[model samples]
Target: MKNLTKKIRSKKLESKVDLTAMVSVSFLLIVFFMVTIDLAKPKGIGLGLPDKNPEWDGKIVCGMGMGDRLVTILLDDNNKLVSYQGLLSYPNEKPKTLSYDANGIRKELHNKKRLIQEYYGDTSRGPIVIIKPSKKCNYKNLIDILDEMAVAKIDTYSIINDFTPEESQLLAAN
Candidate 1:
């Protein structure tokens, strides 16, 4: 009779779930994805172009000569580039074929920039570069030369499409 009177005890079960760890893991995944998305964005190069309609008084502002301050870079096909200092007609340095490596066009640009700065005795006044891309060269070549301009930290530069007869012949010869 006493055993029959004893009620059956049920085992206690834990129904509460600890969601703190799950929440932490979710936040960590969100942060990781956010960081990776930001890193996947594309980078761009800043290019500043001159205005087409410029206000000019038809008068020479300064009488200073540009003979020693000019450096011309001609882009050709097959990853070949030709560089010469000063005017093409009367070049201070003859045109020479150069590569895009550290010891090639890059070195030439650094040396020429230094020489021009020393010649003028002014750090603000840097070399004036004229970049001419031939028909044989591709858009990548032009971009590469522009990149070199930025790498060399040149201040004054111009991309002129019109090439004189002598300049055309010079590129062909090289």
Candidate 2:
């Protein structure tokens, strides 16, 4: 009963936090990262398939050369067009070895383009090309041929990897 006579004291405490500046700093960091990073895009040539046409039914495409004419090109391991021309369904045509200089594939293409314009008329379309890259061909040669294709201004060309028996025999002979 004597403890009931003691007096008691009480104290109060309060705390406050301002989150505006912290949120602003976080938002600024997000924006900075978004602005600084770059996304990578893939690079290379773009190609499409031709609609089924009977004119190409019996033709066997092959060769090595370039220009605004329908030419066939065979890219060998040595990065050379062992044989190139503007017709399919024909025999090897005696595979012509070529250099990468302006006097080689590029020159051949320019000459063929001139001939086509002269004979077929300028109103005629650009040359179509058929590219056959043998299994022994390397990626660099493929790219080089593609670059040649672009430089040759060939509008309709297909990259076919299949090798005909005659082409195989010719390639073996080389």
Candidate 3:
């Protein structure tokens, strides 16, 4: 009976040691995760994301690292796509006018489409149009440009804020 009692005591001791090892492992894992975790908030293009219901398709899509195939449309202080160029030549010059003319937009779109087809052989994957409009741009000009985009059938579009956070804050404070 003494031997039986001793054997039971040894089994209990082994179980306790196993529990201690498991606890130690768990603590180490927790510490490792805490130290290596990334907690920085993600920064985006500052546009508000629409609600997640899939039925709402007007949400402006965002993408990073678009190559030379992108097409950029700039709306100046007057809200016009005055300068239409391939992705490489963006920000080179101010776009020309505020007048609402679909003919010019269609022509530029067709030209860009031809260029893409001639160079890369895939005109179906149309260029991604990034519209950078000035804050004071009129609403009518914006609507006209959007209508032109739709007519041109260039669907991937992004409207970016012209000001950085600091500039925006300064403007707001003023």
TM for every model, in the order presented, reads 0.63, 0.54, 0.46
* Winning model by lDDT: 1
Q: Model 2, 7-69: lDDT tens per residue?
A: 887766677798999999999999878766633344567433223335667443333322325
Relative to the true structure, candidate 2 reaches a TM of 0.54
Badly placed stretches (over 4 Å) of model 2 are: 1-69, 86-94
What lDDT is obtained when candidate 3 is compared to the true structure?
0.57
lDDT of each: 0.82, 0.67, 0.57
- Regions of model 3 farther than 4 Å from truth: 1-67, 77-80, 84-99, 163-174
Instruction: Tell me the spans in candidate 1 whose CA falls farther than 4 Å from its real position.
Output: 1-64
Write out the backbone clash pairs for model 3.
82-95, 82-96, 83-95
Give candidates' CA RMSD values in order. 8.0, 9.5, 16.1
What tens-digit string does per-residue lDDT give for candidate 3 at 25-105?
Answer: 999999888866744445556332322334446544453223434665555444344444443334323333334565577
Model 3, residue 49: displacement in angstroms? 23
Q: Regarding TM-score, does 1 or 2 come out ahead?
A: 1
